[model samples]
Target: MTVPGSAPTPPDPFAPARLGPLTLRNRVIKSATFEGVTPEGLVTDELIAYHRRPAAGGVGMTTVAYCAVSPEGRTERHQIWMRPEAVPGLRRLTDAVHREGAAVSAQIGHAGPVADARSNRLPALAPGRFLSPLGMRMTRAATAEDIARVIRAHAAAARIAVESGFDAVEMHFGHNYLASSFLSRRLNHRDDAYGGSLANRAEVALGIARAVRDEVGDTIAVTAKLNMDDGVPGGFWLDESLQVARRLQEEGTVDALELTAGSSLLNPMYLFRGEAPLSEFAAVFPRPMRLGIRLAGRRFLHAYPYEEAFLLPSARQFRAALSLPLILLGGITRRATVERAMAEGFEYVAMARALLREPDLVNRMAEDRDVRSLCIHCNKCMPTIYTGTHCPLVGPLAGPPAPPLTGDGGRPRPHAS
Candidate 1:
């Protein structure tokens, strides 16, 4: 039944694949979902155990989530920020994952408008002055000095990643973080070199990426999580995002691009389809903010019906536009979906909630092609980032009983990636 001279099939999802200088054992990457175990901004035994399970189960790469370049860049004070003192702990984390035959990537970025300034005791930065609901204050607009410093911080973070034994560094340029905010026409209303035209707006992201690549050279693979769309009105759309993708390819700034959507600042639920846990979210905030959430949470946490490979439709656009390797994210939970992604030219697939639901999901799928994930997409896990990110249905896995549910939502922690 072979057709003569026909093109060969794409590589199997479970087979090895090259990413920059590193060859991952498979094409599945555990996308960065902020692990809430770090209470002191350093790696803890819990955090190590959190990633170790997924690595031991089966994933090409397990990403350490939202490691800020600077303390203020963190979404919450307890989040990890690259520092000399942190290297040893990070080394231990990387070693544990590597021992399981999986590569580990550190996701680095500034939270920008997403930062809970109140908790961090530092002002959040944005392209323009804007209101930060979490902090209940206005964000500070970035100056030229702040911009330069942030770009340099990204390079420094990559250097730390190399020292810490991370095989790859995923620069966070999506989710309405500092760089992403600059890319948004609605969020960025500035008249400087870092704003205005799309080219100008992209300077922050481009500078950081190039700096990271230059800092690490070929010592570590460089990847970016980019937004194909911001999923908000008057925001960065697919058309403009493709242009940015082309520029990144033209400059060879990244080895691969992981396409994602949704703005953590405006619409967090757009990226994660299913029920929005409004009550759980409101429980985590202060009473006044809790009231505010009851009034406006629905607008921010809009729900979309769950479906396998929900992001594929938009990701297909990027796949057609560039020859650069692309990682398709969002709603990837089945082996068939992985096959579909590879068959359609995507070099890799990234999963978050499904893996949180079952760290061994990938290994299970590898054993049986007919296997489907157990994640129901309830979104209950969304609020657990404060205590520990885990499926509430499996209470024991998340670590530490999240204190008795008080009338004010059981002592909520700060919001983060």
Candidate 2:
């Protein structure tokens, strides 16, 4: 994808870079921020239009945020299910981004225990039977058959992603999802091969990665968003995650790694740090959840001070230990930070909220290096994902009252940072 006679590259951030089979125009990627625009697990014009602005603005690539591998894996009823039927709408999204000079990637994943039973109208699945405080339901433990089904679902999603014109597929292994849950000692209590040791716990994730590579070959790039820490007391952490990344590198299942931390079910606030929109969240949910949220929302949506390139410290850990290219996420709002990342050996930086606030931020940065994003880090945007992921601070996705979550993929992607 090429921008039409665009201005010359800046010293660092604007340099052309190649990730796997895709050659990007620059180092910035519009990271996967779940756009709750899909109404029936189908893509909408609003979703397509939502990404085009960033593509035109100047991001080297834009990820079509989390797409479930199966209906059972969706976090909500309206999320796109990665099946043959989803190909047409997905193609439309990819086509739109490509036209604006950006490569497109689909973040494919299974929400696993993070799946909501009340919203999905289906029993949630987990490594072991447990009750989710978030979904407020008794979840089902995945049987051997269920395990096999999810693995195959990931491969099928990758094949469909290629058919739908995606240049890359991001395997979602972070945020306490199916693969991540297996890694959690507190979650995976299975006596079977898929659960005992750390290596065994990671078996499900490794299998899915291999299966995806076996299906897609080099037709598209495979990236994995792996967790460095689960942010819970007894959850997955960096030491174990580094070992997993090494195994993936040896197996050659992924092309790049995007590091993330947090548990969608527990310690949810770890992903995007700033103010916790407790009042906003309470207002968005049903009457049943409103009371529960009002009483304990503070713990669920805890706040952390925002710092530019807040994740660099974690990402640098992966860069020092691995040879594969890495994409730094979280608090990447300025060009100087992007330059710091590049100089430090990180190949790219992924932006979610900043891009949401200003789709043209990349273009503005290219024209003027000192440009700073207007995002306040208030995190009011978190609740808005359900209403179609707009930035309330400014821009089109902002200001529209957050409706309900109506909020809200894969690879052998071993991740770091």
Candidate 3:
């Protein structure tokens, strides 16, 4: 599993590593980069082909981006819907990746208030009524019954992952989504058992994890993409996140944790700042792009351009606090960075934009030790995703429309025109 042309003195990046119950061939992971490749909430040929390229490229595992448990909770127009009928296409996707010697995982979640019901024509549910950053008014607090339904949906989705030949299921518990929104004091204003105290705030995430574990048992891996800091005042921070991680680990509800940051509502730029123009995105944001950019010069932002592995420090800190396997994600794009993460105690390193830039990056890295990625961190890939298009920076192969998954067991038909 050693990368092909790398120096013999350099350690093999593709060697086997344990992730929960599954042992991956390497520490190189194709992180969840949204491809907008799933058409009509089903696994399309384009999605399968896009994922298989990475598997063939040599990543130990590939994670499908953002599978919605319920249609009302989707993040995009073409997000995969975890339903009984969608399992066959998902199985095909996983099988394709597996044939290339890489394991596959599905990221499952509910978008909650972050989604635009006006666009999807679905009801946006949250813990409380709040004005969304997009200027939409979120209505209706999640009732106890609603909470139960969401939890069941997560469990059902996990079951589908198992049946669909997925080796793992990564729970979306970050980025101000359903579970993350509940953990935020500014978002969850309810006085019930599901809100207020830290324990109460974590109840929904804990319940979702428990349900997924119960449904999937010990065979398939259960991982969570957790936000250590939402990068906003009064939002979920490291101390509380660490506590939640510890509790979940003790409960045996999650096998690994992928550390991420920022609330999409308060700071969408933080998650994908590279995509937006410096002036345009920052002007709309509450905080300054840099603390002293006004006093200093523009040289500061240019010096430290947000690239892959930007969240390594947070990942390292979490690794120090817990013995659970940690997957370092963010702007990981180079071999040196990947090696550094492993040396710094991260069990695995995941890449999104880099993979989007070149689906065969793993293979390229394997065949040529000196190969550097072409993903300039321009983040042109982000906006097109909303319209169900591939990355724009990826040349002709990029931006291809997702091929439809036909047959009755394919994707759910689109409700909108």
Q: Give lDDT for model 2.
A: 0.82
Tens digits of per-residue lDDT for model 1, 1-417 = 447897658779998999999999999999998887777788988899889889988999999997999977988777789999999999999999999999999999999888877767889999988788656679999999999999999999999999999999998889899999999999998998988999999999999988998899889899999998888999999998999999889988899999999888888888898999888888876677788788888987899998889999999999998999999998899999999999899999999989888999999999999998899999899888877788888873748333333332233233324
What is candidate 2's TM-score against the reference? Answer: 0.92
Q: Give the top-scoring candidate (lDDT).
A: 1
Q: How far is candidate 3 from the true structure (C-alpha RMSD, Å)?
A: 7.5
**Which of 2 and 3 is ahead in lDDT?**
2
Give all candidates' CA lDDT scores. 0.88, 0.82, 0.75
- Regions of model 2 farther than 4 Å from truth: 1-11, 287-291, 395-417
Model 3, which residues run further than 4 Å from truth?
Answer: 1-12, 278-304, 386-389, 396-399, 402-417
- 46, model 1: CA deviation in Å? 0.5
lDDT order of candidates, top first: 1, 2, 3
RMSD each, Å:
2.5, 5.7, 7.5
lDDT tens digits, residue span 1-417, model 2: 337896433336676778888888898998888877776678888889888979988999999877899887887666788988888999999998999999999998888888877777787789899897656788899888988899999999999999999999999889888899999998989999888899999998998899999999998999999988898898998999999988889899999889889888887778888888888777876678689888988877778888998877877888999998888998988878887788788888899888888899998988888998888998887777656677876745533333333322110010111
- Please give the range of 10 consecutive residues that has the lowest summed lDDT in model 2: 408-417
